[model samples]
Structure formats: C-alpha cells, structure tokens
Target: MVVVVGKEEVVVVNFGNSKAVLCRGGLAVPLSSDLKGERADEKGRCDDEAVVGRTINWNACHLPPLSTTSRSLGGEYRKQYIIMEPEVTVMKRTEQSDDFLIIATNSLWNVVGDKTACEVVKRYCVNGESGRLMSSDGSSTAAAASEAATALAVLAMAKGSRHNISIIVVQLK
Candidate 1:
C-alpha cells in the first residue's frame, strides 16, 4: 500500500505478504494497508503435539500460524496466511526546500537498519541540491533502491537463503 498526500504523489510496490506505504502528512495516514488473516492463527491455540511444535513461534508472538490463507495472487503461497509487513515512507513537502526518497524491502530492512537506509539515500542525492530537494518520481527512487537490494539479496541467495523484497521512494519537493 502506498499513499501520497499534498500536491506531491508517490509510487509503491508490494511483494508477497509485504507492503509499502508512502504518505505526505505527518499524521499516520496509511497509503496502503495489507492485513493477513494468518497472523491470527499464529495467535490461536492448537491441540496436536506435532502441530504445536510447528506452531510454537505463533504462541510466542501471540499470533496464529499463517497457513490459513491458501491462495495468493502470485502463487507464492498455498493455504498460507497473509502477513502485512509494511514499509512506510512519509515525506513532508514544502515550498522552501523539501524533497525526500525512500526504498525498502523485507531483506534490506531486516539486514540494513533505518539509519543505513537514510544514509544510502543521502549518498545518492545530488551534491548541490538541498537534502530536502529530491526527485519527484518516488518510483524511480524505489526502483533504484530495489535494484540495489535485489543485487544484495541475489548475492545472499548464492550464499544459501532467499529473501522477499519491496521498496518505497519519496520526494518532498
């Protein structure tokens, strides 16, 4: 889910059980919302011992297992619950000099902290432009960041594990 407020707009891409939201207002207005029912099952209580072992993490988190949702739009899961792990980008656009960009993915967010993400964006910003004066097309930022994250993920996958990804880009101008 991606929301852009004010005169400016934003672009978002959501993959799998993950979501990205872009908003202009400081108030928490979600541009996109994805709630997966499977979260509840992981919160529920199960009886079978074998099932219990598999569902233990759900109990720890006070959520049910995510296997309840059977079908997904991209055929990523069968009978699996949908989880909305959201990536939110809030850009406060102003007349003086306000431009910003955000790109995110589960893997990137998981490995690289928010500070690192901010630093990456800062590094990409043009030298002369004010920090706030960023690109208007949030999509381009998202695309660039996603590409970087995807490259990283591919390298990680080559090492062994795979990761799901999503990105959000914002410009404050």
Candidate 2:
C-alpha cells in the first residue's frame, strides 16, 4: 500500500510485483520492484538457480511460484528459492519535483509504461501553464486526485489490463 507520511514524503511498501512511481512534468520514475524469480536468482541474492542464465521456464521465468500458490503450494519451491519480502521505497517529495504519484498493480503496467501512464494522468492535470500544471478543478486536491485516478483506470482498462487493476493517483500538493 501507499502511505503519505508528510507533505513531502511517501513510504511505499509494495509486494507481489505491484509497482509505484513518482511523476513530474509528464515523466514517471519507478519506485518499486517486480521481485520476480529469475531476477532474484541473477543477483545471487537467493537460490542462484539460473544455469548460465538459462533455466526451465516453468518455475524460473515466472515469479518463482511463491507470490501466488494456486499453481503449486508447498510444492517444489523452497524458502531459499524465492524472495517474498516487499520492496519499500521512501520518496521525499521535492517542491520542484514529482507533481503527482501513481501506485498500481502489475496488471496496469503489463500493458502500459512509465511515460505513457504519466501522459495519461497528465491529461487531467491540464492546467496548461505550458505543463507547469495545477489541479484538475480549481476546487480541491481530492477532486484532482479522483479525476486523475479515474482517467488512469479507464486508460488501463482500454489498454486491456487482463488482471484486476488497482490504481491510486495522488496530487503532490
């Protein structure tokens, strides 16, 4: 989940391949990790299972069959075979950076990208000012955030997110 601790800081404790990002001026900077199986093995941080960077796709290509158990629970997977801890990123909001933030699951990212998502969200942050931006409606931050979130959800749906999409857009005011 995403937690806004203070005016200029957010702590994102993300898990299960979900992701987070900080956006500024139509660009998105990722703040979370995928925590997939092959990735973990490559870093030698876990059970280095990759044999010359090549392993069977069944249990190697995916997220180590640990994040989810429907495929196989208490099966061949050992504790050392996967990393289940969430990747936490603490972002200290800078007045000059990150106009907003988007926290979403992998479903959305599987179809969209950083810049594209930022652009989609920027559609609602349309204050003009040559992209300097202001709230969507000059009323309240919540309105802007809601509109941006809706826009993102709609766009992700349109882009065909297969899994359930969970998204939150926060205006970094």
Which candidate wins on TM-score?
Answer: 2
Which segments of model 2 are wrong by more than 4 Å?
38-60, 63-81, 128-139
**Residue-pair clashes per candidate, as listed?**
22, 1
lDDT of 1 by residue, 48-117 (tens): 3343323333412211344422113433432233233444444444544433444444444445444444
All-Cα superposition RMSD per candidate: 7.8, 5.2
Residue 172 of model 1 has an lDDT of 53
Best by lDDT: 2
- Residue-by-residue lDDT tens digits, candidate 2, 1-173: 54555676778776444677788645788877655444643334433445222234563354343342111123344344444455678877776666777888777776788788888777666564444334555766677677777777777888876567888877774
Q: What's model 2's lDDT at 11?
A: 87
* Candidate 2 residue-wise lDDT at 117: 83
lDDT of 2: 0.62
